[model samples]
Target: MRKFFDPNLAGANLKDRLLACLGALLGIGLTSVISAAFVHPHGAFLLIAAPMGAAAVLVFAVPASPLAQPWPVIGGNTVSALVGVAVRMLVPAPELAAPLAVGAAILVMSLTRSLHPPAGAVALTAIVSGPAVLDAGFAFVLIPIGVNSVILTLCGVLFHRFSGHSYPHRVAGIAPAPINAALQAEDLDKALADLGETLDVSREDLDLLFGRVEYHARHRRKGSTGGFPTGRAA
Candidate 1:
């Protein structure tokens, strides 16, 4: 019970939480305004789906996460919407259609390397949004879903850039350190493969983390010794 209530589980500081709040506010506010302008004229239908809220959290709060990147935001949501529409059209039964839509969306996004978590909700929205969404047909994918994704992604990019965070982050692509170095690119890759599960972090980010850790360790050793440690003391 104590382990379950660990304070570490809370994670992130007030500043980070506030930044996420701001990002969600900007991303969703803009999306709602744009979506309402376009859709209100047609009829009363949701311009934005629920998933965009989750996407905003990733984009703003954890910009470095692979799932938060532009491709995941745009491609994942778009592809999932498409899959949802297709499933709804093919399966007449709501029970089968809903599950199939979510599962198929996951598979498609995984294959495309655009696996955003909120996209699964996008898939469900397409299935159960009533006739307004259904009448739009394939247009649903391009208009509200696709448009929403693109707009939010653009907003996230601009927000991250101005907020001192990198958007669409890329790996450092540093060459492997010498043989005597602590860890290498190949070693990291092997370790990842062995884990046999997806990680939110990218390889480059992991490498950078390792580099930072090594740097701090070296500095600490030197500081303790009043100079660089020599021989085995290193």
Candidate 2:
């Protein structure tokens, strides 16, 4: 029974956790209100997409995640919604359409390099959002899905900046070389393939993380002991 629990629970401190909660409150609230103002006719589920709530968890709490980035948040939700709307229209059976929409969403998000997990919810929501969403047709994709994603992303960016955390946390910069010889890029690639499941983080990011960890470990050892030897070269 204990094995069923998630081991990797979020380890954020109280301050960071509170910041994420506040950000979610502001982001979702603004997104719902602003979106509904524009699409007042069927504003309930149509304007205020349910998936954005899941998105808030990613954007605010897990700011470092690749899935939380702007492109993934926006593109993933919008395209998945498109797939959902298309599947709903083409397939008359709700049972078939629901699963098909989710599956197609994974495929499309993979090809687009925008695989945000909340997008799965977006696809499923689009299918079961009732006649109002169905009647909106393709326009639904742009109005609610696209509009909501953009607003939420914007909120994340602004809030994170204000809270002194990087919003689009994925940054390009010169990084130190990896000192750990055992963990190569090729090895990570093979491990990813063997897992046969999509990992939320990129291989490059993992590499960088490992490299930084190795560098800091070495630095700490050198500082602690004057005669400490260097680590083996990779």
Candidate 3:
């Protein structure tokens, strides 16, 4: 309970939150405007899907996450939409179609290494959207879903760059200086394999984090020893 209520759970500072909000507004707003202009009738299917809103959260708030990158945004949503449409066409029943679409989308995204969480919502939308969406067919993947994804991604990139945040973050090629020399790439890989669960952070970022923590720990230990040798000289 104490851990759940920890102040650190709040995460980002005021400035970060402000930037994220602004980015979401800009991305979603522009995508909506574009969507409305092109998608005719402009009723329920107009503009963007509900998932795009969640995508905006990742794009703007957690730009560094692997799931928030350009490929993940574009490919994940597009492929999921495609899969959803396919499932809907084949499976007439909404009950079966909905779950199948989501599952298939997840599998495709995982295989493609473009696993964005919101893509599942996009898949669901494609299935349960009724006759209007079904009539639109595969074109649905291209126009609104694909277009919205591309636009949102572009907006996120521009917004993050302007706001001094890194969008489409690249992992550093060189590893940070390690305090524990025994900590190798293989060790990290083995540890991650042991965990057997997907983490939001990229491998590079995790490695950097471990390196920093070890460095801090070593410094703290040295400081506690008053910068003098702890053991007697031989």
Candidate 4:
């Protein structure tokens, strides 16, 4: 049981772990407060808790994803909300409108590079929740949904930054993996073909995340095997 609870070297520092946990909690709490304060929705499903839970999962389980970041959380949800409202106004058939709204949300988010996972929830809420959401109208987009996103993102940025993780991570000065560099040098479509793996996430995202993991694993083995005087090297 003790062995199973061992920490990896890259994240072995106790303070860093504590900070990560704190940041995640703050992110969740801030969002929840804002969601409840405004844009008061009826069901527990479309409430702020949903997006906060989704964000918490992203922070802990999938921290490396671009989709997990602050911008994605805010922009993605807002864009989806707007799309939903537009679909409600424009499209006559929701059977057709629902899928289109979601697709439009995805397209806008991806193109704008703010692809948050919970945005799908906003779109789904817009279509399924029916008249309540429509009646709330633009207020739905502005008050609770948009308001919640901003508060959540602000919390995320502050928490991640103070916790020693980068927020709104700058791409500059960071060198991508050799494979990614090579891929980008070529066209994205062709590069994906060459990789020969079916990835659920974007190929570029997958590459960066895998590269980070591999790099950490290598150092973690060194720290555990070589640096730990209490343990014998296996």
Candidate 5:
């Protein structure tokens, strides 16, 4: 229980952790306040969806993640909300609609390349929310869900400039052949194809990580204390 409950996140220091917390607060707080400003009947409409909380975690804590980028954050949540609202309206049976809504949302998110994890919750929220959501119909996709997603993602973009890591970081890409290559760019592509699943990390970032690990391993075995490796070179 203790092991399971303890922080499993690696490589994050106190400052990093605190910044993530602060970013979450700012992103969600502002999303709620800003979204509420224009939309009326505030009681009927939620200022922001609950899934935005999870989105805040990704956008701030793992800003480099492909899923945390602006397109995914906005498209995933908004499309999933559309899916959820559609499912709720079409299917009267709550039990069947719940699973189908989530599954269809996943399918759409995958095809769109907007597979954010919190999108699952956004889809579910549509199924479970009151008549106000269903009554809002397609408009629900734009007003609250879309608006909230845009604001929260924007906050993430602005906040990370000060958080020591770049936001909307590079997506996976092919690296040139190294002088002495153990891993090739094609190898990463083939491996991902064989895995048949999307990883939260970008291929570019994964390439960098593997290159660093290989550099350290080689140097450690040679027992040389040289300057830290910068990055992989062709």
Candidate 6:
């Protein structure tokens, strides 16, 4: 137990901790507001979306995940939910809907590049929960789920900025592009093939973001340590 809290390895980042708390609080508050205003009978949206929503906001929004973003977070959950509801309403039986719904959600979310894990729950909820959720029909996907994601993302962006952390931090391994151009799908593929190495983003954008983050993290650590900050590399 004592080992768990060792200062050298387990010390908390004050800024990060504060942002996390604020993110969670804002997520809960926003969900509560939506649920209350809508007069949802079960508030299951609150129960399910709150914790998962908070986590999504913290991990994807504040951190600026390469894989997770506002569009992905919101669209993924909403779209997957729509697919699930479609399965439940269109399919023959509840049990069949459950598994089919999950598969449909995953495939769509992946293709759209909005692969949020919790969207699976959203899908299942639409199917197994019966008339209460079914009564929502297609509206359920847009209302609470979409609204909650947008609100949480906005809050996380503000909180992350306030904490002196970069929201939407760039992935370290990728390289930036040489010019800012919206490449077509074919263009992007050609560019990647030209590079002869895989990257998460265009070569130009990657380079720019990496340089900025690398500088900030190293300088901040230096200031915090009150030394040259040896034995470390950003």
TM-score to true structure, per model: 0.85, 0.82, 0.86, 0.64, 0.87, 0.63
Off by over 4 Å in 1: 1-11, 40-42, 171-182, 224-234
lDDT of 5 by residue, 33-131 (tens): 898775736344576778889999999888887888999999999999999999999998889999999999999999999999999999999898877
Please list the C-alpha lDDT of all candidates, in the order they appear: 0.79, 0.82, 0.83, 0.65, 0.82, 0.61
Tens digits of per-residue lDDT, candidate 4, 1-234, equal: 766656563335556556657776777776776666563554444456355567665654345556777778778888888898888778868898889888999999989888877887787678777677777776678756777778777776666655555666533222423422333424545767888975535444444444455456656867744321121111
What is the clash count for each candidate, in the order shown?
0, 0, 0, 0, 1, 12
Model 2: per-residue Cα lDDT over 1-234, one tens digit each? 745543354445667778889999999999988887668365555767788899999999888888999999999999999999999999979899999999999999999989999999989987887888788888888888899999999999999988877889854432444466566678767877899997666566566655656667877977754432222222
TM-score of 1: 0.85
List runs of model 5 lying over 4 Å from the truth: 1-6, 40-45, 171-179, 193-197, 227-229
Q: What is the lDDT of residue 95 in candidate 4?
A: 93
Report the C-alpha lDDT of model 6 over 1-234, residue by residue, as the tens digit: 866543331224545555666767766676557555654454455334533553454353345444355666677888887898789889959878899999999999989878776778778878877686677777777656666666666655666666665555543433233222332335545756887974434344544443445446767967753322111111
Q: Scored by Cα lDDT, where does model 1 land?
A: 0.79
Question: Which residue runs does candidate 4 get wrong by more than 4 Å?
Answer: 1-24, 39-49, 59-61, 170-193, 196-234
Backbone clash pairs for candidate 1 read: none
lDDT of 2: 0.82
**In model 4, what lDDT does residue 87 have?**
86
The residue pairs in collision within model 4 are none
Task: Give per-model CA RMSD.
Answer: 4.8, 4.4, 5.7, 7.7, 2.9, 8.0
User: What is the total number of backbone clashes in candidate 6?
Assistant: 12
* Pairs of residues at least 3 apart in sequence or in different chains that clash in candidate 2: none
**Among all candidates shown, the one with the greatest TM-score:** 5
If both were scored by TM-score, which would come out higher, candidate 1 or candidate 6? Answer: 1
How would the candidate models be sorted by TM-score, starting from the highest?
A: 5, 3, 1, 2, 4, 6
